[model samples]
Target: MIKSLDIVSDLGEGFGSYQIADDDSLLQIVSSANIACGFHAGDPRTMASTVQKCIANNVAIGAHPSFPDRVGFGRRGMDLSALEVETDMLYQIGALNGFAQAFGTKLQHVTPHGKLGNYVVEDSKYANAVAEAIAKFDDSLIIVTLPGELAEAAKKKGLRIAYTIFADRAYNTDGSLVSRNQPGAVLHDIDLITSRVLRMVNEGKVTSITGQDITVKGSSLLLHGDTAGSVQMATKIRDSLIANGIIIKSLNATK
Candidate 1:
């Protein structure tokens, strides 16, 4: 079970000033916002606008980088190496950091987009390389990853880690996320998502698809803004956590 409650949102492609319907609502609720860094989604304009909001709310901003597959939306896996993943992540973070500096905010962390995130969690070499990239780019930058393998690997590389659990997403029996290709991967039931987060925050465990409770930590939680009830779900999560006396804060602030 996790010891704290922190919520993050994946802002997707509506970067800069672009508002693709109800985007700003979740910004106020989540403690962090994972803004797209071009390859998967988002543009310079959208990135700039989202940064301003994050600054205003004191929410931490992270680079949600992915393989250069805008057409696949960065969800599908690609043939990428340790070196390739590191460079790609660096490029995206550097781009956003450039705009964030203009708004007087620093890029606080980096989380791999889609398949790359899952990849590094299981592959030690890939994980270390990503961590090395982050350290080389700026050791001060935090890395948000899963609690078990991914978080451990990042920590081994001497990079700051923000252990995270997905709020609106479910994990398989083995702790990997339920693949999107599978029918119940993305949660539409607001009740289910909010309940899962509450369990993670209070119990420090997650009930995998096999109905087995596995120990987990919840340093940071995510709400995929691209998911259908994400805005409403994130709002309810914030309210519920506060109702339970949990503090809603960005990973950096709490750490």
Candidate 2:
């Protein structure tokens, strides 16, 4: 059978007058989108417009919920109770779902944003909270994340899981992503990124920052639209994957 991959990107990360990536261009390249939901970088108008665009481009929409940190772009960590995390996530998901409903589509998945994403990988409490929120909102929604506590919690809750690998980020020896604060954490070279993606999909492995080869599921590949030259890199990676006979699919169609 031919192998399939899901290409996703974070979009709608704009507030009032400030915009972050060329979402329109990136939408054409990605099969799915993790749209920022107010907390990190989106507003009511932006969310509605993004949902419409996703429908227009036939891209699956997923919620990219984050801590209430617009200034830090959800990259900074916040300490909160389990209840707070669960409620916050539910609020964000509900807000985005409203837009999706208005646009005649629904959320295909939920992926934590920035620090919360990292936390879910390391903290079971946060993982459980997130999973509970997703389960309560809609058990059918897929949880897009790396292999970790979140995945485990989602499995326990009977929610579908989509293991994702970052196309523009570096990995650690333990299969976790390297911290963005570290040097070389985010990749920029087009050839190198594409090659890494190919190896991860074809070989189920990626070279870590420590020069060690690590195993990965790579069910989905995430591309950050805000990164420099991200559009070009995404286009090249998609073309290369197709050239090699790998099918590009949406997360909803992966399973």
TM-score of each: 0.92, 0.98
Candidate models: Cα lDDT each: 0.80, 0.94
* lDDT of each residue in 66-149, candidate 2, tens digit only: 999999999999999999999999999999999999878989999999999999999999999999999999999999999999
TM-score for candidate 2: 0.98
- Give Cα distance to truth, residue 114, candidate 2, Å: 0.1
Ten consecutive residues with minimal summed lDDT in candidate 1? 14-23
Off by over 4 Å in 2: none
Clash pairs (backbone) in predicted model 2: none
What digit string (tens of lDDT, one per residue) describes model 1 on residues 24-43? 78777888888889998889
Per-residue lDDT, model 2, residue 195, is 97
**Who wins the TM-score comparison?**
2
